[model samples]
Target chain A: MIDPLSIFLLLLSASTPILFAALGELIVERAGVLNLGVEGMMITGALAGFAVAYVSGSPFLGFAAAATGGAAVSLLFAVLTQFLLANQVASGLALTLFGLGLAALFGKPFEGVKAPPMIPGPFRINWIVWLGLVMVPLIWWFLNRSRGGLILRGVGENHDAAHALGYNVRLVRIGAIAFGGAMAGIGGAFISIATVLQWTEGMTAGAGWIALAIVVFSNWTATGVLVGAWLFGGVTVLQLRLQAAGVKVPVQLLSMAPYLATIIVLVLISARQKFSRRAGGAAPGSLGQNFHALR
Target chain B: MIQLVPRSEVSTLWQFLTPVLAVLATMVAGGLLFWVMGYDPVAAIKTIFWDPLFGMASSYSRPQLLVKAAPLILIASGLAIGFRAGIWNIGAEGQYIIGAICGAAVALAAYPSEGMWIFPAMVVAGAAGGWAWGMIPATLRNWFGASEILVSLMLVYVAQRVAAWMAFGPMKNPEGFGFPGSRNLQQYPSASNPELIAGTGTHWGVVAAAVAVLATWFLMSRHIRGFHIRTAGLAPRAARFAGVKPETLVAFCLGLSGALAGMAGLFEVAGPAGQITDKIGVGYGFTAIIVAFLGRLHPVGILLAGLLLALTYIGGELAQLMLNLPAATVQVFQGMMLFFLLGFDLLTRFKIQRRVVA
Candidate 1:
């Protein structure tokens, strides 16, 4: 049987990639523009980070490359939805398809190749896990305490009002979108560099969508994102542990727990979103609505 | 020196030309991508577009077009309806898996029993599975304003694992030597959906795809419900004011899409695939999204668009076998189609003009 402490640590590590992506998307949603391309971005980051790490023999360089790759794809989204007034949802979806395709094509050459050795970490916990723990509080501070954070919340609450106040909604949004993409990239890199430790086609395998749900499961708060990631991580991590323990429950049924948890969490959050008009925890006012200023 | 004049009517020619131009643009951009990948761009493009009908390998790959297109058209046609209504059902993949699971479950339960009712019962169960899976988001969204897109999508992973479990567990063929998968449905005569036209690759699913197109066309063009769907999508406030109950519309759109998607899964399991396993839902749910978008969400467009996308699948395989190109290039090509389509679609809503400084 696996040690409980190691299993707990393993779950924390597994949760990091999803945590990074969810937190990033949370910030983006907070700014009123929904980017559904996090899956594409994550995959792109996975490939980019993996490739750079392989070539340069530096995991840090890989992370940087992943961020660049994610941001680059996000730039297309920013231009369309922010500048061209395209529908945020559609543009984001298109970006995902495009990114997935690009990654697949790019990844073909790297198929069967192994990633470099992982960057060593403190106490059997890697750098990403430590950073992910730090990022949760850091993101909390950035969103709630900082001036830029206030502006971001303002835009999400009311883009037109934010614009009327000369907050440069487009510029702030572009920055937020890029930041979100970079974070998603880091989350993706965690998979390639730290977890799976190899470049496989479609390796991220629905992690991006899980991250997206984490934002909702977290109730759109940075702290909630960490808890949701860890919560999901615990469920997923538990499944693997159950499989190892040779539990009689079919691994298939065991696997259902994590997704079931996600659905349950979503149900709870949705129930709140439904009833909360009376209780008042609303999605940011301008979420999923594109802003077109004719100034 | 250009004279400043009032903008006249937008030409009808632009509308017809835009979608075509986007397709052509995807091809050109796709060729550039091929070039970057160090493959012969022209040859790659030829395989994707020209090979299905006129290329040297046409005779061999021609039939697979129908085989591949059948499921895509079936799924995309359903997805297009919800997409048109702005319901955002992204979990068709999950629906597909659950439908297969339900259908396969019915078959597994009736193993070694030869009955006429068994197959039909499986079909009904398949649809129920899909409908139930789709209702997760539909009910959630209708009751509580959750994003259906995320909920629907998250379920795909869950469905996949469930599929893996079933294939490796109780659903496994009892008599067979402990292999993960159950008895191949292909070997079972009563449950199998065989090719009606033999080499033409025409199966029950293809007929279903045809039926879907006709039904969708009739529904969208001649039905009052369809008008409500369009109105709700284009102008939600106007739709609500027009007395089109928003919740009902959401439920109907999701339910309809789910049923059609479910039927597609049933047909696929009984036909070309011939079995339900972890590999059953092979990106069709997601790929169908591209088909829906590529076809501009029109049933007729989907018919032609489905074949076109199917051509890429066939050609992608050919490219892989003949030219050593990766299988993923076709997806890249598909992605380019959306990029070009959205970029071209910009013309429908806006036009650019230059302002000269005095």
Candidate 2:
């Protein structure tokens, strides 16, 4: 008795958080930085957004705070890697750990608090959900057609060359990181403020990691990211529907399908890149490497 | 304007000094956080760092340090090796869970038997299970060119679900009136990992951690293979020239670390935890990454870092009991410590210079 339109809408809403996050990370990667703290940014956003929404009774304000909070936290990572010249991978991991702990510490009081109801957009979908949908084309345009995106790609492909061309590599990367953080924050807030409408500890529950996997699966394309998000969203919806329909499989085992699917897709994509000669890898050249303007 | 000039030679003194500096910085930063949270920052810091070893309940908390530190040290020891080799096996939590499940399966199968062989069999099974789980990512990376970091991390989620399934389904204890957990290994005298010395918390895991530290120290300092690992990490092209096979090193590092993590899990299930439950993967796998880095990826350093982190855990608990602080206080401290350590490590690698604005 599940209607197709309703299911489609459900999938859109379900995929919104990951969509925002992957899009943000896509930009960051294009700028030659790998911030593995997506999960951290997200959780921080979830708590901050929820707390704001509860206190102010405004979901929009909640989302704004989430974005600011996420960017603020990401600045910590920017300072560490961009200024201190710490290892990008380790700093990113540290950022995640730090963000998670900071969120939990402050989030204790917000436990059991309900978020204000989110106002729906034109067709009854939440406004944030619509924003996520619109961002796909917006990001695709920015990455492929914009002059600024070309410069970002140049920086990612070769920082030294970009620096020679008189671009501020560090500033570009920090901007990208901040944007990624804001997007991840909005995505995280969507979970607590829109979907669940309640704050809980560790409620993001690996969505941040799932978003990371989606980015990889997308082959760094905005459209590919859309497809990847939908695929994951489809799996999540289908699994929950099966559980509701009294499927014979154990609930715990069934819940594992999304994660397992992520692994399998990772293997397939990686294998394709390995086996195919024509597939020029789209991974940004300076991805995950720290930039230093050495004279 | 400022600039950083790479030091011709790494500063050995700064290497030794940064960790101490990092800890002090974290204490200061953490104190600010506590102050912002409206808590008595000084007292909270004292409860976490000072009161654990010398306070009124020091006798009880002191023994608990070994118990808490054992798994961290054991897991970090193996992880540090892989890290040094630049092989990130971040899925130790998954390995830990699978190891416990396999080890418990062996014990669960031989229920009601008095044979001593069961305990040893569990250990072997645990290591094998972890090794097998770890090999999945290794194989994928070798064959398909996948990022091990992503693959290993993804496996952690899958492992958590599997653990939940085991707890509610096959591993549920029949005698416990439908409780979603297995037979208590503590009550099963032959299977339990009891303290070796009374009131000292000297369990087999603690002994294994000590052994791991020593073994790794010897390997990193004395073995040729260790040289190969370091070379591979620093200069992969040079490592290849030196006859070091990248595939082999990847497999070895991941496998060995996975096995060690599994053993840690086995010891915990048979000792501290007492049964298999859905909540078994308690962020130890992730925390050990910090321990590895904080220890400067050195075995002896990991030992000290492990104890320090475990102290935070015990202290965090004491703070909760005594000061009504949230349980997450310890986690926040841990995160802050890592942040400070990474930030401070810059002093050892480069010379900060004032750019002469011409």
Best by DockQ, which number? 2
Clashing pairs in 2: none
Taking chain A of candidate 1, what TM-score results?
0.95
The weakest ten consecutive residues by lDDT in model 2 chain B span B145-154
Runs off by more than 4 Å, candidate 1: A1-7, A278-280, B1-15, B112-118, B356-358
For all predicted structures, in order, the TM-scores are 0.94, 0.99
DockQ of each: 0.58, 0.79
Model 2 reproduces a share of the real contacts of: 0.72
TM-score of chain B of each: 0.93, 0.98
- What is the C-alpha local distance difference test score of each model? 0.84, 0.90
Candidate 2 local lDDT, residue A133: 85
Model 2 DockQ reads 0.79
* Chain A TM per prediction: 0.95, 0.98
Give me candidate 2's interface root-mean-square deviation: 1.0
Number of the top TM-score candidate:
2
Tens-digit lDDT track of model 1 for A1-295? 5688998898898898999999899999999988999999999999999999988988889999998988888888888887667667778888887888888888866777778887568887888789889989998998899998999999999999999999899898999999999998989988998788888888887788888888877878998898899998998888887888899887778877877778778878878866765442556888889786655
lDDT of 2 at B333: 86
